[model samples]
Target: MKSSILLLAAAATLSAQIDRIEGERIRPHVKFLSSDLLEGRGVGARGGQLAAEYIAAQFAAAGLKPGGENGTYFQRVPLRSVEVEPGGALTATAGGKSISFKWLDDFVATSHTQEPTGQFDAEAVFVGHGIVAPEYQWDDYKGVDVKGKVVVLFTNEPPSTDANFFKGKALTYYGRWTYKYEEAARQGAVAAIIIHTTPTASYGWQVLRANGRAQPQVRRAAGEPALTLAAWVTTDAGAQLLGLAGRTVEEMLQASDKRGFKAMPLGKIHVAGKFNFKLQDIETVNVAGVVPGSDPKLSSEAVLYSAHWDHLGIGQPVNGDPIYNGAIDNATGCGLLIEMARAWSSMEPKPLRSGWFVAVAAEESGLLGSRYFADHPMLPAAQIAANLNFDSFSPYGRVKDAIMTGADRTSFFALVQSVAERHRLSIKPDGHPESGGYYRSDHYSFARVGIPAFSINMGGEYEGRPSDYAAQKAKEEGSTYHQPSDEYKASWDFSGMEQFARFGLALGIEIGNLEKIPPRVDAK
Candidate 1:
C-alpha cells in the first residue's frame, strides 16, 4: 500500500513537469524553421546549415551539454552527390527494331558505381520483384545466373495474407525500391530497371520524376557492390519494352504474384544505356545535445529522441511556389524536439538515464544522417536504452488516440500503453501498413541496428471535430506533401503537436527510470 501511494505521487509530479510544454512555445520554432528564408533546409545547403545552428542555439539555451564529437553539438556525415547529365539515351531493341526513350519523360537513371562515363548493352531479364528472403523460402534469382544482364523488376514484394510470409499485407523492407537496387547489384547484374505503377510504388509517376531528377546523395564506403545503372521506367514504357518480346505487363504481373516464379529472359530483347554523371563530395551535420542523469552509474546508459530537419530543398515550381517548406512534414517535429529538450533539462531529480536530443540531416535524401549516427554512435550500441523518434506531426487540434508504429515489436509496448492510458489517449494500430510506415522514417535506422525505436504522432481520431475530420485532413495532405504548397500557416492549430510532445516526455521519463533497458522483441 505504501509503495502504491509513492508511485501515485511520482506520476503526479512527472505530469506537472510535462505540462510545462505548450503550443505557444512550439509555434515560434515551427514558424521560423519552415519560413521561406530557410530555403527548404536542403541537405548540405546554406539553409540546412542555418537550421542546424538554430537548433544548437536552442539546445545551448536549454543548458544541455553537447553530445556530439569534440565537445560540440555537431557530428559530420560524409556523402557524395550524384547528378546524371542530360542528353543520355536508353533504348530497347528486338528483331532489328529499336525504340529510344525520352530522357525525363519516359525514363531516368544513374550509375551507382560512381563512373563519370559508362555504357551497358545486355540482354533484358525479368527477375520478379528482385527479392531473396530465406525465411519465406523465396528467391527470385534461384535458377538463373543474372550476371552481366539488365535485370527488370517491380518495386514491391509478392502479395500475402499470412503474417508469417513477408509480413502479410504490411510491406517489409524487402519491398522498398532501395532493396530492389541493392539486391540487383548483389546478384552481379550490370543494370536494373524498375517498372513504376501507382499500386506498387504507392505514389504517382510525378513523385518518381521529381526524385529522379534531383541529385541523389549516397553513402558508399570502399568496395561496395553497386550497379552501373539504376533506373525507373513508366508503365507505358515498360509495356512497350515488354511487347517487343511478345509479353504484356498484365501477364508478367500475374505470373510474378505466384510462388516458385522463375526468371524469364526476354528472347532477342536487348536493353542498352549510355550516361555521364557529375559527382560532388559534401558534408552535413547532425545536431546532438544531452541532459545528464542524477544517478551516477545509470547515467552511462542513454535514451535518445530524434527528428529530421530536411526537405526537398529548391525544386520544380508548383502553383508558382518552388520552396518545399516542409511545414507539417518535419518542422513540427523539430519544434517538438526543442521544447522537449527544454522540459527534460528542467526536471528537478533527473531520470536514471541520460536524455539525448538529435536533429538529423538528409532524411529526405533517404535517412542518411540517422544511418550515419547508427554506424558511428556516441555511445556503444548496447548502452543506448531506447530511441523515441518524432517525424511529421499534425497541425490539427488535439487527438484522442496516438499512433506509435513499431512499438508493439519491442518490450516497451506495455509501458507505452500505460502512459497513453494515463493521458486519456488510446493506443492505435497503423492504418496503412502497406506503405511500410515503419521503414519510411529515421527511426528505422536505429531499429535496423538492434536498437528499440519508434515514431510518435497523434492518431486520426481528433477531438471536438466532425467524425470525418481525419479523412479530410489526410486527403488534404496528399496534395501538399512534397509539393511546394507545404508551407506554414499562422492559422494552424498546434494543440495536437503539443499533445504528442507531452506524451513523448512522459514515455521517455518512464523508459529512463526503468531498472533495465527495454529489449527489442524482434531482435535476431
Candidate 2:
C-alpha cells in the first residue's frame, strides 16, 4: 500500500514536470523551428542545412555527448541529385514494329545509384504482382527467370474481394514499390517497372512525376552492381504494351490475384530508353546525441529515438509565401525529442541504459538519413535495444488515446499502453491501415535490420467533441499534411503533444532501467 502510494505521487510529479517543460521550453523551440525563416526545412537546400546545424547546436546545449561515429555529432550522408532531361522517351519494339511513349504522360524512370548515366536492354516479362512471401503462400515469380530482363509488375496487392490470396482489404509489404524493387533485384532482374493507377497507388501520377524529378536516395551495394534500371509506366502505357503482346491489363491483374500465378511473357517486346541527367554531389547531416546511463554495467546498451527534420524546402510560392514550413510534419516531433532529452537529463536518478537522439535529414526525399545511419551506425546494431520514431504529433488538443503504427508486431506497445493508461489516455490501433504508413518512415529501416522499432502518431479520437466529428477534422487537417500551409497555427494545442512526450520518455526510462533488453515479439 505504501509503495503504491509512493508510485502515485511520483507519477503526479513526473506529469507536473512534463507540463512545465512543454509549456515553457518545448513550445518556444517549436515556434522557432516552424518560423518563416527556416524556409520549410527542405532537403538539400540552405534551409535544410540550417535546420541540421540548429539541431546539432541544441544537442550540444543539452550537454548530451555526441553519438555520431568518429567523435562527431553529425553523420554526413552522401546524396546524388539527378534531374531527368526533358523529352526522355521509352520505346517498345517487336517483330520490327515499334511504339514510343513520352515521359510523364507514358513512363518514368530513376536510377538508384550515384551514377548519372546508365543503360540496359532486356526482354520484358509481365510478372503480375511480383510478390514472393511464404507467409502469404504467394509467389508471383514462380518458375520465371527475369535476369537481364524488364519485369513489369502491377501496383498494389491482390484485390480485397479475393479472400484466399493476400490480406484482401489490407496491404502487405509485398505491395509497396520498395518491396517490389528489392524483390526484383534479388531475382536478378536487370530492370523493373510498375504499372500505376490512381486507385491502386492511392495517389495521382503527379506524385510520381514530382518524386521522379528529384534525385533518389541510394546506398552503394559494395560489389553488387546496382540494378540497371527501375521505372514506372502509366496505366494506359502498360495497357498499350500489353495489347501489342495480345494480352489485356485486366487479365494480367486478375491472374496476379490468383494463388498460382506465373510470370507471363509479353511476346518478346523490346524496350530502350536513355537517361540523361546532371548529378550533383551533395552532403546532408544526421544530428545525434547520447545520454549515458547511471549503472556502470548496463550503460553500454542503447535506445534510439529518431525524427526527421527536413521537409519540402522553398517551392512554388503560395500567395507569395515560398517556404513549405513543415511545422507539424516534423518540427513538432523535433521539439518533443529535445524536450524529452531535457527532462531525462534533469532526472535525479539517471537511467541504467544510454539513450541516443537522432534528427535525420532527407526523410522527405526518402528515408535517406535513417537508411544511412542504419547502414553506418555509430554503434553496433546488435547493441541497440529498440528504436522509437515520431513523425508528427497532435496539435488539435489532448486526446483520450494514442495510436501505435506497428503495435501488434512489437512488445513496445505494451510499455506505451501502460504509460498511456497512467496518464488517463487510451492506446489505439492505426485507423488507416491501408495507408501502409508503418513502412513509409525511418523506423522501417531499423525494423528491416531486426530491430524492434515502431512509430507513433496522434490518436484519431478527440474529446470535448463528437468522436466522428473529431476524426473528420483530423483527416481534413492532415490533408494540409505536406503542403506549405502546414505552418504552426496559433490555435494549435500542445497538451496532447506533452502527453505523448511523457509516454515516450517514461517508456525510454523504463527500458533504460531494465536488466534485459526488450526482445522483438514473435510476429516481429
Q: Which one is best on TM-score?
A: 1
Q: What's model 1's TM-score?
A: 0.96
lDDT of 1 at 179: 95
- Quote the lDDT for 368 in model 1: 90
In the range 364-397, model 2's lDDT, one tens digit per residue, is 7778899889888888887788888988886777
> lDDT per residue, candidate 1, 129-245, as tens digits?
999999999999999999999999888889988999998998999999989999999999999999988888888777766565455466676789889889999999999999998
Off by over 4 Å in 2: 23-28, 31-36, 93-102, 120-122, 134-137, 159-170, 236-249, 314-324, 474-478
**Overall local distance difference test of candidate 2:** 0.77
What's the C-alpha lDDT at position 261 in model 2? 85
